[model samples]
Target chain A: MFVQATESSTGVSHDVARLGRLVRGLPETALVVDAITGLGTTDLQPDEWGLDIVIGGSQKALMVPPGLAFLGVSEKAWKLIERSKLPRFYFNLARERKAQSKSEVSFTPATTLVVALHTALEYIRSMGREKLIANAAMLAEATRAAASALGLGLFAESSPANALTAVSAPAGMDSGAIIKELRARFGAIVANGQGSMKGKIFRIAHLGYYDAPDMFALIASLEIVLTKLGHTCELGAGVARAQEVYLGFVEQEAQAAQAGRP
Target chain B: MFVQATESSTGVSHDVARLGRLVRGLPETALVVDAITGLGTTDLQPDEWGLDIVIGGSQKALMVPPGLAFLGVSEKAWKLIERSKLPRFYFNLARERKAQSKSEVSFTPATTLVVALHTALEYIRSMGREKLIANAAMLAEATRAAASALGLGLFAESSPANALTAVSAPAGMDSGAIIKELRARFGAIVANGQGSMKGKIFRIAHLGYYDAPDMFALIASLEIVLTKLGHTCELGAGVARAQEVYLGFVEQEAQAAQAGRP
Candidate 1:
């Protein structure tokens, strides 16, 4: 079974843990998760969930430029791949494993990008991966609060990803208008909905390389854009709510640390 | 048929042009040239030589860091590839072409390295690719002249590449000693013979990002290392010869430019 941990295009976060449980006890079955945008920002444990394969991309929560993909394949999947006689060339794991064993890459790699990723990964390690995930979660919580205060509906309200929040545009107003206004006024480039949701929703991304100040600016801009687009919006309403959420998170973190330290 | 325009591993250059002519009448045959290190440093015209495919690397004549491999596939080669039943995932040309037509990469790309390559290519284009190749040829000629003056025999005397010159070690002496001494004394990182010829020869690279001054320094350092290692070499003999070559090249370039002005 192949499933995306979160669908970025549709702003849908799938119940991956539930899916993992459903596929258990099927010895021949392998659960493959596309956690390209979910890893480092969400709760995903391939080992704990018995996932056979997990695919990741560098450009998302890794805070690196795109161009690299990472794969986690379980021992059982390796056995299955070996037995299957599908003619594989470039992505052949066995060939890559053989080269890696000798301390070499199977192909010419983007050397500078790898160096940059190494540096980014070192910083991530210094902060601890869990801490980074917790940061994303905090930011996501703040953004959700801000969106609700602004009277905007969540696109993925049932299951929102910590990496980003997708909010529907005000009734009768295209999201592209707000997206353009944010870019022009505040130099904030938000993503308009893709596919069928195009122009209907705008995404506020707070994944890697984002902080509380950025979220405040985004929410403040969103309020201004909504009012400018003729929607009845109270300026600072969203920003104040977002600030409250941020304040609450900081206090909670401090209390948790205080309790744990004692 | 597959052949290297210049074999960097063995310091040998093949007669690629002649081979291209040999396969002309055979419609089913496609000549593929591995010009990884040879492309910018050597004189090669794939189209003129009826080559169906040419492979290049970023770290070679482009002066960019390694991790990128480029391919020039002719329409004829594409037809053959389409007809062949090969299971290629990552290097799938058709898939890449489709994505590229929509102005996107087929996979997450090392964004920074591509940007670096773009800058290097812009510089290459501004100077003219032919000029860059000529510069490499001049440097290679000077290195060859310097090696001859130093009483060193050429490893690929019959077909030496313009990218680098490989010199045979003195009789009964390992090339590793000369290589180590060069690095230790002058900070020159010359390459030792690879594969079966290891320790038999030392190579002086004059490919991309190299100039006449670098050549002079390398030859002077070689003279010092050879003398220190008990070889009876005149200290300034190679340097003087290289200076003459550099002077000759400058005079020829000035004369040609002067003639073209009229």
Candidate 2:
């Protein structure tokens, strides 16, 4: 069974832990999670949660240009894959796994991107993967606080994704106008809602290569653009809220360290 | 049905045209061709010969780093693919084809290598693909002539591949010795025989990025290495024969051009 750890299109996070529990007793079932948007930003434990497979992409929170996908497979998945009649064609997982064991690939690989990914992964490792995920969560919290302060209704208010924050346009306003204004005025391009959600909500990413400063700048820009597009808001409310979130987060970290929490 | 346009293993060229003819009577069968080493170095016509699919790689003859694979799928192949029960996994040709029709990819592609491949393909197109193939053939011809002059037995004498030429070890001499000696003496590394053919024959590639000067240098190095390894041959004889082949090919090309052949 395939599950999405985070639904990027809707800016909602999936209850992946519940999914593992739902299929724990089924020996034949394999839970494959699409964690492309979740891997770096969300705290995911595929193995501990008994997920059979988790898929990720390079361009998401990994902060690289698009072109590679990563897969984390459980032993159960491998066993099932061995018996699978599916003609693997080019994406032969078994072949890839065997080759990867030897630090080789079954087929040609993107050398340059792999090198870039190596550097990024090394950096992530140095900083700790958990830290990266925490960074995303902090950014998301800040963005959410700013959105609330600016009187913007968030699209996924109940369970907003850490990868990005989606803010819904106010009454009678198209999100496209805000999106265009942000790009035109500040040269900062944000994502619009995909498919049917288009023109209803604009998304602000807080994933890879983003920090507290970037969030501050983005939130500030959003405020100006929203007002210019006729959706008036408090001039400095968004940035101010984000700054408060940052300061609060730093204090929490310090308190946790002082408390000797590993 | 599947066939190879050229077998890089033993440096033998397959009669792909004959294979196409042999399978012409089988309407339900789709002939697939592996043209990885053959693509830019050999003349192949997948459309005309009713080949259902032709596979190629970026590093072979295309003058690009290894990262991408190319496939030419005919209408028959698509029809066959539609009926195929094999789970395509990541190598879903149908999904890829649909996306590619609009110049989009279904999966994350290696962005940097794709860019590199695009640049290499553009260069190949500007130079004309036929010229590249002819150049390979000319280099192979020169290498073959040189090998013969040096008293080295051609492994694929009857059907030598245009991609590369394989030369057998001379009388009780292991091909590995000559390969090592050449590398040690001149820093020129040639491929040793694979699998069962190892220690018996060594391969000299005449494919991508190779020209007359390269061939001359390679052959001269081989002559010295062979002598050092207890095999003796006239030093300038191999180079002279290669020069003759180079001149002959140029004259033939000029004559063909003058005769209004495209």
Candidate 3:
């Protein structure tokens, strides 16, 4: 089992492709579980990645209450579940699958949270999964470019997730302090470094339920935070970079469409 | 380890005494962890229950996202922590204690969910913990009496949790069907039987973020459901019974206060 999380907060597309190659190479690995990582900020198609199992939670890119976990199982993984012996009393994939056939849950499901998750998924499906993924990727690309223009580096040196763009604080500035200031002064909820990089980096999420304007506002806020924290960053540089990335994405997609014309 | 979740959602003063006896009986029971089953919907004092570790999650009575888990540990539990070696990497109680000392979280905490949990807890604290529990118990008591009057039987039979009333559906009717109808027709969400009782019983929750009106509303909805499904039930009977329970609870509390007056 290979567990790969879709973490493209800044729309790094390379990681998904890299994962595809890794999955193709592993023969003994019965399942490849994408922990909503392939979607990046944009919701990626399961078929597109050729993944066996895609595990998604309600809170992340789904933008709903956190109770339900959605798993899209491939035929291969489904067959292997019969032999997979992980001690799962509550999160049993087989039980959930059986219940799902009748539009029900195996356990006494969290009624209210499941309802919320259902509603959120419905909205995402209605928006068209392709479009949602594209929007997320575009948002991530824009955010990353904006952060780069501010002279701050990204946490993931390569192959970043499109859901959030982890930005490094300039030399001598504390990323933790910047996160606190952003929350205290602006009331904007952004993420910080996880695991070993707690004070070394900060994260800006551009996932579900966000737009271009939100990104622009966030960039502007970051610029202020950088300046107040004694970091020398051009006032409009971040926003301008974000705009450039957005325009570039639109142009590339348009060109691709024109090229596909028979 | 004998885990005894508090029986009632709004556990009565008598329930606390019962729990005390249960806790005192166990030997080598280094920890008395209180899941406080109905604590969210009912009133509780950690001190009153003689709880060594009180555990709570954000979904039930604390109307918030589900990622946050709160634990209030006693000195005895803290001392035992020096000996616990149960391969717990994610939920390390000792790490959490250290973080709490500095008013922080041990791991990469679910920042958004914690914010939501804080808001919900604040709402409860503002309403007054005693009043909140009393209100939940009153509503639950009413729900139970109303359910019984309507020819329904309690599922937990001998000891029903006050946070939610679980009722066994009539022999011919599917409990799942009743649960589905309550949500589909009345836009009300009720719980279904958990574990072994799936499809056999339905639950009506009347805990946090609820009042007498809410409980009565569910009772009235249940009556409609019973009538439509061929059970003999008069509309308003359940609601009236629930109302009587609420009034009785208030009167009893008033009498107890008067008797203990200085």
Candidate 4:
């Protein structure tokens, strides 16, 4: 069973472990999984969770062009593959496994993309996984506080995601129009709502390679958009709230490090 | 019938009328047409070709980080909403369309990627579509000729793609190992055979913002790889062949324009 990562990007730490227990509780001897959604953006360890298969695409938290999808499979899943019969050609996991063992791919892999992926991964490694997750979560907290200050409702109110922030559009204002204006005017591009919420909300990403300043720029543009749409809210209020959240996170991080005395 | 493009840097032009005829011949109406393999790299007018939808991702020819996928649907596709049922929440087309009309995305679109894509698209527009395609094709031709001169076999014997060139691995060397060494020692990343052809062949990409000189550099790397692998081939043959192809392409383009004169 695939657990869609709607807005739980802080780290799959809790959900993934819960999923592992649930899957293992089933009567089946083995379980196969596709952990593509929040794999890179969140902290994930397939081995730790006993996940059978963990798939990842080169984009997203990996910070590279698409074209490459990486998968990690367990021994139990490997055995089932011999008996399973599904028409597989391009996305053949078996062949990919064999090739990847020798540091290769199963087809004409996207070379340039792989190069960029390599570079991006190197960056991730240098930053450290724990720090990356912390950074993403901090950004999310800051953005959420800022959105609240602007009187914009958080779309995913219950379980906020660190990958991005989704805020409801003001009454009668088209989310698409705001997005278009951002692109056309300020050259800032944000996301709109999906599925049932289309045109009702917009999203701001603060995932990879982003910081407090990035959030400020985004909030500034958002203020312009909200003002243009006649949404009454105090200017700079949102940014100030976000700044406070950011400062709190930094302080907490410093305290944690200090408490871990040698 | 989504055809994969060989031109890694750009999209190719397919005969729209013929494709329309092929789709019309199908027994049932395809609900969600996934043009995943070719849309971004090739120039396709789904609306004109009787296609219900056209899909693309931010990477490939779009020249952006890969997390975003794009879909363009026709009027007929929109009509499928009443009867169609696919378990889709994130990649829902209708909701995205509604939001897109206002120039927004249906979900938390990758901000960094969106920014990069916008930059890439504008860059393409500046280069002009015709010039971009021509440049991509020319680079592919140069790569193929150079590889051929070095006694390397082309992987795709028929309808070889202009996106990238796939070459057979030499008799006694592992293409994957060769790839690793090239990347590790020289900082040049070439691709190894994917899927069924793993370790049997290698691929070289000549797309997006690359030129003949870049292709020349790749060919030189190939020579070094071959020599180190104990494969006997003329030292400068590949480079010479690449130069000839580049020169020939420029001449042909000039001649074609001249012939178009009234």
Please, what are the lDDT tens digits per residue for candidate 2 over residues B1-262?
8778888888999888778876766767888889989899888988777777899988789877766787999887788789898755567898898888989787667677778888888988998899999999999998889888889999999998899999998989999998999888889989899879999999998888888898899999888888888788999999999999999999998998899955
Structural similarity to truth (TM-score) of each candidate:
0.86, 0.86, 0.72, 0.58
In terms of lDDT, the poorest run of 10 residues in model 2 chain B is B83-92
Off by over 4 Å in 4: A6-14, A27-37, B1-262
Write candidate 4's Cα lDDT for A1-262 as tens digits. 5554424332222366667666765544444454444554566666677666676766566766545667777776777675568656765778778888999666655556677878988898998877777777888888889888998888777767677778888888888988988887788988777667779888887667777898898898888878887888888999999889988988998899899987
Model 1, span B63-176: residue lDDT tens: 988867778987778888888776667778887888889897777676777888899999999999988888888888888898888888999998989888889998988999
**What lDDT score belongs to each candidate, Candidate 1 first?**
0.86, 0.87, 0.72, 0.71
Per-residue accuracy of model 1 over A116-222 as CA lDDT, tens digit each: 88999999999889888888888888888988888999998888988888899989999999999999999998899976999999998877788889988889888
Pick by TM-score: 1 or 4, better one: 1
Model 2 regions more than 4 Å off: A21-26, A82-86, A89-91, A100-103, A170-181, A257-262, B21-27, B75-94, B101-103, B169-187, B257-262
Model 1 residue A63 CA deviation (Å) reads 2.0
Give a tens-digit lDDT track for model 2, residues A119-148: 999999999898899899999999999999
User: How do the residues B1-262 of candidate 4 rate in per-residue lDDT, one tens digit apiece?
Assistant: 4533233322223454466667655644532444443443345566666766666666555566555666766666677653578656665677777888889766554455667778888998897766766776788788878888898887775656555677787777788987987887678887777557789878776556677888888788778878888888998899999899899998998899899998
In candidate 1, position A243 carries an lDDT of 89
User: Cα RMSD to native, each candidate?
Assistant: 3.4, 3.4, 5.3, 7.9
Error of 4 at A15 (Å): 2.4
